[model samples]
Structure formats: structure tokens, C-alpha cells
Target: MSVVETLLVFAVIPLAIVLLFAVLTLLPGRAKKARYKPGQPWQYQPVWWEPHPLHGPAAGNHDDGPKAIGSSVYQEPQAIGSGHGSASHGATSHGSTSHGATAHGATSHGATAVGASAAQPAPVSAGPLGGARGTW
Candidate 1:
């Protein structure tokens, strides 16, 4: 075949076909949707949905509506160890004392206690501490 015909069949036609598809793909995106810009008031209505409405705290019984999402509710922290023979901070083998204190509630210094009651777990506090923050 001639050079012009060979180049048309091997390169020019393939390049034209690729360019045609690229233009076609980009044409649809040109008709853009309305977008939010900085300093402009929002034009869309907000929507909220809860899956289990009947079982929630509001439950249609309260004068006010259901609580908003991400609202904080403060709950009193309960004591970890409550029952007898349970391990609390520095309880002895009989499980009736605390912090190296004797069974008669007398405090003792430098007393070595063994088992799970000896090691004190770190206290957990609610709310966020200053650290890394993120958003979705």
C-alpha cells in the first residue's frame, strides 16, 4: 500500500476514533448541576431520618420532638466493682479491704498485695481530649 494509505489505516483513523470518544465522554459533564459556593446561602432543604423511631427516648411521648443527631447526653459513671469478693483497688485476698487497708478499715503503708486486685486499672473519663480531629 502507499505511505498515505498505510498511515491512515494504522494511526490517523485510530487517533480520530480516540478523540471522538473523549469528546463524547466530556460532553455530558458540561451540563453541570447547581453547586454550593462560599458565602452563598444554601438552596437545598435538609432531611433527617431515624430508623427506630418507636424505641427511641422521644417515642412520641415527650412534649419536645426527638433529640437531634450527635447531641450529647451526660450519664453518671457507675462504680466498676460493687459485689463482695470482687477485685477493687488494692483489696486483699478475702476481698473486704481496699488500698492496703486492713479488714478493720485501718490503712497500712508498704503492704504488698497479690493477684488481680493489686493492679489498678486506669480511670476512664468521658468527652474528648485534645488530640487529632477528623471529619467525614
Candidate 2:
């Protein structure tokens, strides 16, 4: 064969191989599954850094969001009611009043006022009057 023909054949063979591989890879199911690949069931098999005796990731770490006392869930500044393990000051965006307003009881998004004599309600008075007074 002529030198040019032989060289073309050599180069073409590898190029064809690479192009074939590229095409197959671009074709669905070769890597991540798509809707067209009906034969394959796409599943995300999570590899555990360690065995999960409790199943899923352990309770903390990347456990959704900031771990707090009452609620658990991550959410945006506005959507704090969904339950994703994050904490919110729960104060309204505008600095106003929480009066006659059930702050952290269920009316608000788990938010208590800054001086809310409730949330951090006098860690000193879990005693006689919900921390109101000494006696009746």
C-alpha cells in the first residue's frame, strides 16, 4: 500500500475507535440513564463512608441542616415551616411587634421575639409560674 494510504488507515482506525466511543457515550444508558433507555432501571446507589446500622446517613453531620431543639429541616429565610432541620430567628423580616401574636407557639414559623421572654424563657425559671412570679 502507498505510504499515504497506510498512514491514513492507521490514523483512521484510531479516530474511528474514538468517534465510536464518543458516540456510544453520548447515546443514553452508557453512563447516566435517561427516559429513552427503558431497558435499564436508573438508581442512585449511595456508597456509605461507613456501614449505616440505622440505615441512611447517621443522625447528624450532613443531617439536613443546623441541629436545633424542637424542629428539624432546612429551608430558606422565608420557608421555615417545612421541617428540614435548620434554625430561624423566626422573627418577621420587618422589625415590628409580636404582640397578641403567638410567637413560637404555632402561629409563627418557630420564631420567638428577640426579647421574647419565652424561647430562651429565663433558663432560670422552669419553676413555679412558667417564670411569671413567685406565688399566687
Backbone clash count, each prediction separately: 0, 7
Model 2 TM-score, all chains together: 0.23
Each prediction's TM-score versus the true structure: 0.25, 0.23
24-103 per-residue lDDT for model 1 (tens digits): 99988885777766777776532223344444433433223322222322111223332112111232334333333211
Number of the top-ranking candidate, with TM-score as the measure: 1
lDDT to native, each model:
0.40, 0.39
lDDT of candidate 1 at residue 119, scale 0 to 100 = 28
Lowest lDDT sum, 10 consecutive residues, model 2, at: 45-54
Backbone clashes counted, model 1: 0
Candidate 1: give the clashing pairs: none
Model 2 bad stretches (over 4 Å): 26-75, 79-136
lDDT of 2 by residue, 20-53 (tens): 9998888765646355555665574221122233
